[model samples]
Target: MHDPATHHKPRIAISACLTGHSVRYNGGHKASDLCRTQLEEHFEWTPVCPEVAIGLGVPRDPIRLVGNPDHPEVVGTRNPGMDLTGPLRTYGEQMANELDDICGYIFMQKSPSCGLERVKVYQDNGHPAFHSGRGAYAQAFCERRPDLPVEEEGRLHDPVLRENFISRVYAYADWQRVLAEGLNRGALVNFHSRYKYLLMANNPQAYRTLGRMLGTLSKDDDPLVVGPQYFSELMQALRRCASRGTHSNVLQHLSGYFKDALTPSDKSELQELIGQYQQGVVPLVVPLTLLKHHLRNHPDPYLQQQAYLQPHPESLGLRNAV
Candidate 1:
């Protein structure tokens, strides 16, 4: 399997249409400017259009999910008998098995074969049903690797979701690196320590739960068994969106490290910035930038090592909008 950590740009899988490829049924692209321009520098994208890859030609008949929302069949919109579900699922399983190094996936929204969520499902009468269905390939991929960070391009427009998705991608890549090198108790402990604050901001309960699990690791225990369990919990925790209160709590906790080094004015200003962030008066970048500046001046080893400080590259400017 390829290891993304070895590459300068983390590998990501994206819907071909989102990359401006003419792979849609209408032979057009649903290009995402952010993915093509802003995030292009940070990630090496592998575009996959399940419809196209499954031998559905360009300008092909449109398809829709029909049957139970939870287990729908992809069939032609004009001719319900023209089913394409089997081929799409086969292609998805093959892609999921092959793309083990992909750190994240960017799905095209509302696609019958790639949307992450809420893709339309039609009834037997050819009328639209509730929007509770996921794309066929997307469903297969999620089942294959639930730990991987997955998001729809449209949802990435939301600042909070975008930040969370990118953060998860970096964290997942780091976790994969640990597994690739060798999974040992010490490495796992160090990984958890670095992500302490980041995990707390996502879910305090999981932070404590995972810490306790790591604390109980024994020499007799198999790392392969324990590691999967830990990762499953970690991914589930990250899916919980962090709120302003949680972020403010984490920021305050981080500020304590520089309390002695900061002057009275500096301390007051930092607290004020954090307060503004908590009250939604400012984005997280404001206080985080100040903290980063202080960390440079004071140089606390533990604080400097925390992934919460720079979860992803600052060049991505993810926190600017958050």
Candidate 2:
């Protein structure tokens, strides 16, 4: 009975340049139409430019990661002595605490200050190294909140990664809401119940392992201890993009709920659609929509509450791509 129209949009942190702010080293924005326009309808954004926040001027000299890839230093390309490594790391730590309320972050790709991965590191001779390193600011920020969902703008163009990221964002937002309401054994069980099929689709082994952890809890157990472990495992499981085979497995399992209600033709049609989806003839939304329609007619309370049925806002059309 939940209406997404009334649901609060999850708050997100994004690179300021992606929001059309001219905060890049060249003094121009790397504006993302997908984030600034399409996704804006579903998420509240907190634009952050770590470079600018660290007191770098617009149109400033570009910086590069140098020396060891594992512990590279952020220094100006034109002047090696102009190191901003400490400042960027400091700002990242500060923002990680400041933006605690945000459920997710979208970083600018290939940015020396914001790229999530595969950023170039330079040698003493100014040649790019064989191995790449993450942005100093991004490395520090993620270290502070490893469980928080994050993706780069470039990676978002991949439909599967995009869907997975959005799904994780909403799931994290749900966990945030649960924390706000205060945690207990019953609340934890209920949260896990809703994500049952979702977790299974993403990681079958993790789903069983997490369920057993909760199943073993007693009334005397502390939510403070159990909650963090459960949430951490849950987020990690969701990080994996569910394969078509896994999704089809979940769909088959879901169909079992209506076995007694569906007519022979209805069952046949549903099975056909699922097969097509599994074989990649159609997107996941096709089978998912049909299942939803049948559920509407049959009305099973347990099945109705599953988050897998509607992971993110349907308006986002995320399932259509996957």
Candidate 3:
């Protein structure tokens, strides 16, 4: 089993209000117990409140996104002309430039300055016209680091999204470590090989596309140029949540490696467990446990090396929820 405490915890950027800080416009906190308690052991958080950083006081008037949903202006709800968009964007850009070590971010949902998605955009007449706008700081963060895994507090409540977010965070950290060690064609290829099944479960098309990208690498190719493109695609691939069907496909593929080693009864039992998982009759942990059991007995080198079997720390119990 992977010892999480022995591994380096990924640095994560989190909204200050979510960390139990009284940084909200109403002078209250929207403390997420999950972040403060559950995830503390796994993540090192860097709390930030863009509004507060930009000189907005606690208990300040609430702000809203106005005008175009795609490019909304941030302004005080009580005073339309009181724009904070410029200051927030400036702060966001600065954070993006400086927070290069952050592997992921957790934003407060529906925040005018920090929401990840579906923040309300009001019309000139003051009616909420749409929920299509993203928060100013969140938008800037995305533009700056498209590779980073980002999630809203509300969305993280879902088991699948929560699992996916943590998985990506760990994966991104691993990629960062790889780059830190000096990325070369050989190192990149080895990295991709380890994540093969994981990428397939999330998005088979992207998995194949990335494989093709790896195939194009040459001894003379520049790691500096190729590394960015590879990671960009890898992150985008991971952004697509792994579905039951896709997971089943990967599981079945893994099972094939042990087909010759298993008896008729063992094979039947494994197939049934995978079927139950695909049908949502049981959590993913069931089939995965069985697979690990067989893997221990069989010990195929390829399957043993694959990251899909243990993407993140098991202590987190992420698979149990999904």
TM-score, structure 3 vs. true: 0.97
Q: Give residue 59's error in model 3 in angstroms.
A: 1.4
Number of the top candidate by TM-score?
2
Query: What's the residue-level lDDT of 10 in candidate 3?
Result: 91
Model 3 CA deviation exceeding 4 Å by range: 1-6
**Tens digits of lDDT, candidate 3, 138-248:** 888789888899999889889999999998998899899889999887888888998999999999999999999989878788978898899999989998889999999
lDDT (tens digit, per residue) of candidate 1 on 1-322: 1222344677999999999999889989999998988899899899998888878889999998988999899999888789888888888889999999899999999998988788889887877786579999899888998989999999998989999998899889889889999998888888888888989999999999999999998999887889889988898799777889999999999999987899999999999999999999999999998998998899988887788888888888888888
Q: After superposition, how far is residue 135 of candidate 3 from its true place, in Å?
A: 0.8
Per-model TM values vs. the true structure:
0.95, 0.98, 0.97
Clashing pairs in 3: none
Against the unseen true structure, what C-alpha lDDT does each candidate score?
Answer: 0.88, 0.92, 0.90
lDDT of 3 at 276: 96
What RMSD does each model have against the real structure?
2.8, 1.0, 1.4
